[model samples]
Target: MNKTTWAMVTFSVGLGLSACGEEAGGPTVEQVAKAYEMYMNVNLATELGQRIEVRGWEDFKPGCKSSGPERVKCITGGKVELMGFQGGEQTVPKPVSVPAEFDLEFEKRENTWVPVRAQKK
Candidate 1:
């Protein structure tokens, strides 16, 4: 193979390896976003008198930065459907498209990162 092609392959492999290694230090952005969305739905349900389930949570690309050895800050801006009751209704829920973003902090507990606090942005 040409040297240029070999160098490109080497760089890609190294980048992938480094990303895998970083997983040992903290939870991923996806985890933080899921937890944050769950909490938001709970509050929304109580206040709106309806149930809410966030769909497509895995697709949320929350901006995560290391706050400490066991802490991470996550900011979110993703589209998800809230599937559940719309109000004080008991029937099946109709899915609603929602564009939401949240700022949250997570602390590592055991083998998972749990949301500790949420801040308004």
Candidate 2:
């Protein structure tokens, strides 16, 4: 087989094996909170065209439950600065500290839980 085909087969086999060996149980509260923060930052990056970090997880809560065999649902919230640049050259989106709250759902793929939904609350 060519090098490209060999690499593809290897990757496919690895992915299949990983799925078969996926972790069980819901993620920890800390992990759920961090995942929420990451998703929020990703959203802000698109709208603000810059990174605005989510912070203050000291009072964080994951109120998570098993929504499915490999899924979890959480009611969580946090804060982030809504400050971005001033135009298409980073146009002003206003700079202000804001509450970031959401009802999020995650699915376990392999060993990590990935956010599958983020409904604003």
Candidate 3:
């Protein structure tokens, strides 16, 4: 077979295998949001404690706040900033933001709302 034909065959096989091997109990938006929150809590707590231990002051803070719903905007060290969602009743819109944190960048994967791999921020 020609190179193009062989490449197509390989691509097809890979796609089929990946689809078949998809993990069970696939992650959901709710799960990802919760994981994100847990990660943030732990990481931020550690950072806060570390600064206190090293600098002898708890003045340092992670400037962030919940913008209603499951959304949060965090600005860290005046450089990096992250926006995330943790599915909840407060999510924007009346019914609820099903795909809560739906279109947000730090949320999309392959154009679909997929569970975050980091399991934490």
Candidate 4:
């Protein structure tokens, strides 16, 4: 092969190898967990005067090994607190606490992680 062609081939191979070694561009396991916790807390507080307090997370997987880049799933645990009404005509309800689990799925689109599904388990 010509010197110019050989140089181009070498450069292409190097670039491909570098790209392969790089990590995927998307939210990490911790970031995804934090976002999910925040979403649950905000929605619950808005709708039910309650919020979920995340104590910790476990069984977190950043990417789906079997399904490849298209799907990722994470699981977490927390406690949900049912807040009492403050300064409302209705009587204040007693606060209730419950243990909760979350199952979350995320998809990769154009190098970004998009939440595809979320469930309370």
Candidate 5:
């Protein structure tokens, strides 16, 4: 193979290895919050045929002073606009803004974090 082709192949292999190594960390606080928001939205839609418009989060921080590597806890305040179904057959739309507080616990499973428990504060 030509020198240019060899260099490209070597770079590609190194890039792939780096990408694999990058996957070995747990999710950040923001990622956990996002996931929680998504979970809430999916659950609401499935159970009540409603949807939430996530405004944002506040006071997001680690729940414990020194949480171990395996388990993590986080607390945050979230704002969401809840859209409810109204009228006949729940076909109408009514949206209301709601603020919520959350305490979430996660466990590091392999390379990802999974929420083990969640509660509203």
Candidate 6:
């Protein structure tokens, strides 16, 4: 084969390998976004003085650097249960530690949403 052809082949192979290695079966950025969304939702509810609870959870991204386990809990006498997904971002970007679980409730006086509690599992 020509030198150019062999070089092209080698480059292509290297690129493919790099892509696979970067992913490394870790949690995706999307997974982290989802967890943030859920956490926000629960926190909104808790601010309104509503009850909250959590049970077991599953990690969306098993090996993701920013992905961790999520727990599902029953709340308000099973009226409102929540599953919280954790983002593994440490003290680099975000000012607060990544939450392991989130409990949200509502406030009757202000009719607003708030976070009742956040815990690190």
Candidate 4 regions with alpha-carbon error over 4 angstroms:
1-27, 49-69, 77-100
Which segments of model 6 are wrong by more than 4 Å? 1-23, 45-121
What's the true lDDT of residue 97 in model 3?
Answer: 16
Q: Score each candidate by Cα lDDT.
A: 0.53, 0.52, 0.26, 0.44, 0.45, 0.27
lDDT of 2 by residue, 7-89 (tens): 11111112222221123355555555455555655554545555443334445545667788877787765543444443334
Clashing pairs in 3: 69-90
Off by over 4 Å in 3: 1-24, 49-121
lDDT of 3 by residue, 1-121 (tens): 2212211111111222111112222223233333333344344423443211111112212233333333333222211123323332222232221111212112223333222222212
Q: Pick the TM-score winner.
A: 1
Task: Tell me, by lDDT, which candidate is best.
Answer: 1
Root-mean-square deviation of every model: 14.9, 10.7, 19.8, 16.3, 14.4, 21.3
Residue range 6-101, candidate 5, lDDT tens digits: 111111112221111122444454555454555565444445555444443343343332147676565545454444443324343444556545
- Superposed by TM-score, candidate 1 places the C-alpha of residue 21 at a distance from the truth, in angstroms, of 13
Candidate 4 displacement at residue 98 in angstroms: 8.2
TM-score, structure 3 vs. true = 0.23
User: Model 1 clash pairs?
Assistant: none
Error of 1 at 108 (Å): 0.5
> Candidate 6 on 1-121: residue-level lDDT in tens?
2222221111111222121113343222233223334454444534544422232223222222212222221121111223333342221332232334422221111321122222333
Better candidate number, 2 or 6, judged by TM-score: 2
TM agreement with the true structure for every prediction: 0.62, 0.56, 0.23, 0.43, 0.48, 0.23
Worst lDDT run of 10 residues, candidate 1, spans 6-15
- After superposing candidate 2, which stretches have Cα over 4 Å from the reference? 1-24, 77-100
| Two-way lDDT contest, 1 vs 5, winner | 1
What value does the lDDT take at residue 65 in candidate 3?
A: 35
